[model samples]
Target: MCGIFGYVGDESAGPIVYRGLETLEYRGYDSAGVALRSGGSDELTIEKRAGEVAALSVPTVPDAISAIGHTRWSTHGAPTDENAHPHTGCDDRLAIVHNGIVENYEAAKADLDEHTFTSETDTEVVAHLLERELDSLEESGPDSPPRDGSPGRPDGGTASREGESADAPDSSDVAWRVRRALESVVDRLDGSYAIAAIHERDDCIVATRNESPLVVGHGSNAAFLASDVPALVEHTREVTYLDDGDVAVLTPDSVSIYRDGRRVEPSISTVEWDADAAQKGGYDHYMRKEIHEQPTALRQALGSRVDVDTGTASLDVDFPQGYLESVEEVQFLACGTSAYAGRYAATLFESLADVRATSVTASEYAFTGGRDPWRTLAVAVTQSGETADTLSALREARGAGARTLGVTNTLGSSVTREADDALFIRAGPEIGVAATKTFASQVSTLALLAIAVGRERGTLTAATAREHLEDLTALPGAIQQVLDREEQIRAVATTFADSDAFFFVGRSYGYPVALEGALKLKEISYDHAEGFPAGELKHGPLALVTDETPVLAVLTDGAGRRESLNNVAEVQARGAPTIGVTTAGVDAGSLDVAFEVPDAGVFSPLVANVYFQLFAYHVANEKGRSIDKPRNLAKSVTVE
Candidate 1:
């Protein structure tokens, strides 16, 4: 989940990468770095810092033509300036910034010598390996035909350390030398990686993704590459999503894509979401800003699923004619917040698509036995495609010959590339470790996908689906209604902040929303809150409900479902503070406090999360835990 940025343009890559990293800082990382092929040197020069990207200290960003950068969530080493990316190798002749783990880096590192390498990071292994391989290739192939018709020199330029002349191997030669080295290095690596590099003396930047993410952003005489669109949102709307095993080289005047050593067709997709979605505006915390942004986020996500002109609601997938028809079952896999959405998706699929979709944690799905794979569809969901378990599950399912699809927010994440089909959530960048908008967007996308299946099968009528589509457009306002209540919820949160423990309960669709709310509380507030289906209260949870306990229930304006309301009354009998989220117009009689939300056509985990997140966030703020960087947690799931 590291945020990566690269640019070959008139603009300073330092400023672009720095700000872009800030936009993506919500993903959580320990260190950051950027490498530029400065005009004064033929070798790649770099600067890096531990901690936040904004904390990186650099002397100056020279008016260089190209640069590559990474904000890392550390894996192989502790968070420190020395472990940061843009790691130099081959005596600083090549620098590389990487986003994923290197499984064989140690074995690869052992094979290289005479190439001085710095840093203990697995990413450095890539640089050293690239440097050595390229050097070997150059030596074998009559020496890289001097980059740009310039004289080549040993040791990549300068006299200070390597006995190289001041006139040195030209900067252009250094760049070509580096690129050739990188191309050879690319051929050897394994595992997921989005690699960006600045070749010594080379004027252009080259990047590649193999089961990782990289996007290309367009500019007038400028180009950009970032792990996610929000990093490039400020620069351009026209972007290209790189597929797995795709290589792209970007220069100010051109961007080229290659696949299997041949020029490949690259589709440029225009991004509708812009810099505004990535910025926090005036809010002190991204959670708060994103809680408020949910209104617009919901509208946009819903907009993509439905074509107003066609009056149809569908996931943006067109399967082969016989695939969906032969599908007999579906397994929905995800972890964390996306997992909660998957639970609800299973329910929606049962009712709307008339299919039994079993929702399971990705780890179990990938490794467990006794699951039927034939005639099944594996749907994996995540805000970031780099999620390991989810990706592993998708791989296993595909190995078993199941048709697979992915619903993800990032354009070119591993999940996006690995799935037989994939759809991007338009919720933009969700910075808070606790997902707010994307959670809602994922479930909404799932619902849309459900509707799409129904439409494709003729199980759903066009008019009813069309009305659901229109109601989705109004979700922005419904979300706004919830955002407007944060100040009031802040007051409510104070009542629960002192409680020793919290219990959340819900039934039917409310169960997943309850689970997500509990997760948000656990993720940031570090609270001991747990969600249980209302039916489970009598089974065991009732023993924990006492006067000191607080009960936050998803009681959205529903008529008594017999035993469920009776269970709620049982909680009140124990004198637990019962905070209920209900429809605004409903009379929530005798409830301690009723957090009212606008009535969405269906019970939405996203909208419900907004209200619950406000309560948890305000409680966390009152309890004084850092919301942005919770203890023992980092953004981006880089480590397994």
Candidate 2:
């Protein structure tokens, strides 16, 4: 998950790019860069570094009105100046930045043997290709040759056939040359991307996306493209989600779109969320604020997934019916918190639909691989939809001849573009790095897909699916009921504030919650927390129960999972002070603490998982870590 922002309007590019990336810090990145084409100079001036954008001491932006910036979550190479984008072609002739993985980079790299490279990035290949195109376009443009005085280079020009570079273009010729170069360059790309380019000769900004997200703000000349919405919402609520293979060129005075070499009008979408929704709202940290936002967050998601007017629950998804018919078995693949959602969905999938389901953690999917179990279906789950391991597994499943479906929150995200069919998790933009609302949304989408399958196979009555969808629609209220207990959780976190080691135990569906609980604390809190299947205690983990390690147990009463409380008692007998996540008002005072979740179905993942996330987040915040941009824990893993 990387943050990308561009401005082509009258606003100052520096502040816009900076503030935009600040909001996107939640996306997670290890490096940052900005390329701007000022009104005068043609070349794109770029300053990239190998560290958090928040930590950067970048130089002030030049006086140009149009600029583009990127916050990179490393994929092709290590975090370094040479590896960060915007990557340049030969002698900075062309510049580009990209957000998706190019599966055929090795082949592209071989073609670049004659060209010199300054960065070890997959994204740089676009620059090289663009440079080649620009070189060919130079001779035929309205402007005969690019003049001198570019931004990155005070002088700009191309290299001669004999290998000597030509003089740099002057300021007046920058815009025309840059635009022509880009038009030619853009035609050669073959993979997923959301691209924004600064042509040195043109007064405009050239931007586009193919199976990637690019949104144009409602303002007459303003435009934005991000993997998600919140980054651009600061400028305008009226927006458009660019279609697959669509190209959009933006300028302060104009915006045009194209599809498969033909011009087309893009559909506009209005977003109601305010910039303040992306802010922490007086909370100590964004993670804390988002964790508390789960209840309303869940409700908002439910509202989007189902149409209130029709009372007919639909995925609100657009895909060919033929795609669904091709799917058979489903392998639910994801990493970390998302994987738990996948596990719950696997159960939901099998019960609601006539399909067999297998849940696999992305990290281990390859190792467990082999065999034609059936004409398989791959359902990849991710909050950001950019997880590296999951992407590889999706490709692996596809290679195995399975139909692929993507369940993700980010529209135009990589997984959505790759899948044969996709169901969007209407979670909006999840700002907290540890994930609260996103996790719930993943479950929501997966469940809905299951319902959709049930509808298809006739296993689930349409009325039953509709009623459950209605219940799902009401889940926001139940979620809100849980968020009201934030103060209570804050108080509880203080109790374990000084503890270093912890144990999380649960049974049944709660097992994943316990595992997720352990994961959240370990990721950001720097705590050594272990999650066990409760029943696995006697096998080995029980030895670690001690006064020093606070034991967290899942005990949701009235949820048919009473056996978990027995293990909660077992831990207490061993002198491990316990904290339990259970249904509201179930008193387990002997357990030292009990945080509550409303009794829900396997839909319980929608509530309980969030509560545990809150528990971990508060503990980390109490320890004073950057909860939103956790150390070494990225919001999205986009490289394998």
Compared with the true structure, the alpha-carbon lDDT of candidate 2 equals: 0.69
Highest lDDT: which candidate? 1
Q: For model 1, state the Cα shift of residue 221 in Å.
A: 2.5
lDDT of 2 by residue, 55-147 (tens): 655436566677777888776799898887788877774467777667677678789898888777778887887776566545444323432
505 Cα displacement, candidate 1 (Å):
1.8
TM-scores, all candidates, are: 0.85, 0.79
User: In candidate 1, what are the lDDT values of residues 278-392, reduced to their tens digit?
Assistant: 7778998888888887767777788756775555776668788866656667788898889998998888787667776889998787524555565688999878877877888
